[model samples]
Target: MLSLLDVFTPAAPVWSVDDLIRYSGSPPSTCYRYLKVLCGAGFLARVANGSYVLGPRILELDRTIRLCDPVYVAGTSIAQHLTDSLGYSTLLCILFSDSVMCVQQARSRDAPPQLFNRGQRRPLIAGASAKAILAHLPLHQLRSIYAKNRKDIASGGLGSDWEHFKRALKQIRSDGYCMTVGEYNPGVMSIATGLFNRDGEVLGSLAMVAWAENSDITAFRTLTPEVVRAGQEISARIAATENMMDLPARAIG
Candidate 1:
């Protein structure tokens, strides 16, 4: 069904049955069957010309994501402000199992870095954004992630062994942030810190990417305090939002 949606884009919003069949790489019968099901569910709209486009269901899902996603609600302004103030790009990543997903990115420039953007997903075993959240995750979860990705963990210099990985995480926790230079992108550096929810669970990571060629590694250290402050501010706001939503339920209980 989603394959049918992928057939339409901003430049070309409408697709005929042949277009859908071609783009979806499915047979005509299967494409028609899926299109019929999706149209019946209000996920696609059919025109008199036999072309189809996204229907109300996509809008409903988009609205739900905008309103219900905590990071988007609390971190957007903070990230945008930080990017504006710093003249650098900032990213907000959500913790999704062993993957760190770039759910929101706040950058002012017309030409942004091509690596991480909204909806980009990367492993939690590398980069400051991933490491920052990993540093704050519960012990059991961290252990499980490390157990599954031992080679990646070792390659990232986090650890070759369990004790070493634990120590790396401990240091990150003590410093209150994680810093990596030329780790993910050569001549590019990133600093990141964890965001927490109302219950103090690790919710996500906030990161800023800067060009190392322009800014020295030592200069990157200067960004730590403000970046951390922005992350904490977003975290607090999200916590308040969650707490308020839980308040009514608590009263009922």
Candidate 2:
């Protein structure tokens, strides 16, 4: 039944009962019964044209998560502080399932239109924000991801083969951060470092972004330490808080 909600997305936010039935491959009677339960429970709402959209309960849940999730609370303050001090946009992104999702963003005055804004997910291949977390993932998980995306990994220039890919990520892991220019977003430079939990598991990445024209390549490298520091501070904050593991991050919308 919950799978029905997966059909609603930014590109197609409304679905009729007929559409749901066809998409779910469920009989009309089963679809109607599930929709009735979902609508009654406020997981979905019927529209004027008999289509349905996500209901207010989802908004309530989102609000609750932003307010109560330890990672979000800590990352929000850290992201805002970095943006204020660095004069660059700051993003806090998490590893949501296999994708990277931005959960918090603090934008500077000259910041470009965000390629992936808060609550939006992006692929795990091209950007510093994604690579920082990718480099820290457990090797078995990394191997699985690489096996599934060999072509994309090669296209992103990480490597053409699994061993090469592992070596590339190993280098980034040793460096403790990833820096990229115009790889994810044209004309933008991003430096990212991993955020970790109490158990030393990677939670996400903290990235600072600026226009390429505004930053000198050599000088930009200087800010890498600052971004790394912010990432560590956020990780420390997560560690200091009790029961953080119980509060798994809800980063995707």
Candidate 3:
């Protein structure tokens, strides 16, 4: 199921039979069978271009998960409130395998048309949201990711070498947040911080973004702490909920 599901991700949202076989490594005959069955089941749709994409059934499943996702449950209200108060766009993101995917966003009515990206995954080596989470990841996992994506990592300015890359992450870890101007989207700047659960496991990242031209150094100085505070608050709530879930039934009573 997951292998089939992976073919419709942010990078390859549409796929042909051959594309699926290449990515999924399933035999052509087996891939053909599943694609036909999936389209028939409404789990995928045969698009006009003869490629397959996720279908209505997948949307239904996504909605169900969103309604239950702790990140969405704990984040939207705060994200919306932050957007309203700060006059910027706020977003929640989580690790989707080797990258980070946007899960939720709230745009201030006063802000310019916000970046219309929700569900798009970005390389974890690039943006403030990804960096914040990347800084908190286990060192081994971070190194593993870097080893495979070194070219992207170097080009994106995390570092050109291992020592430089480690230093960059270490600085972010020490700062407890990441701030970048025009790194991902030119003319857009962002501040991000990590979220953690009860076991101190990295949950995701929370970020606020605004136009860089109008936002000077002073604006960054003002917004960074606010975004970081919101991230910490969300992490606390997630941790508290996790702890509650871990409690014995009799303990609750």
Which of the numbered candidates is closest to the native, going by highest TM-score?
Answer: 2
The lDDT values for all models are 0.81, 0.86, 0.78
Question: What's every prediction's RMSD, in angstroms?
Answer: 5.8, 2.6, 6.0
Count of residue pairs whose backbone atoms collide, per candidate: 0, 0, 0
Model 3 clash pairs are: none
* Per-residue lDDT of model 2, residues 1-253, tens digit only: 9999999999999998888999989889999999999999899999999999999989999998798666687889888988898788998988887889888889998886654688888888889999998888887788778888899999898999988999999999999999998898788889999888887888889998888776787787899999999999999999898756643333233
Best by lDDT: 2
lDDT of 3 at 28: 86
Evaluated against the true structure, the overall lDDT of model 1 is 0.81
lDDT (Cα, tens digit) per residue for candidate 1, span 217-253: 7876798999999999988898888423321001000
Candidate that beats the other on TM-score, 1 or 2, i.e. the better one: 2
lDDT of 2 at 136: 84
How close to the true structure is residue 239 of candidate 2, measured as C-alpha lDDT?
88
Listed in order, each prediction's TM-score against the native is: 0.76, 0.93, 0.82
> Model 1 clash pairs?
none
lDDT of 3 by residue, 1-253 (tens): 4568765666778888777888777788888888888878889888888888888998897897587666766788888888988888899987767778788999755443546367788877888898988887777787788888899889788999889999999999999898877777777778899877677777678998877666675656687888988988887787767423321011000
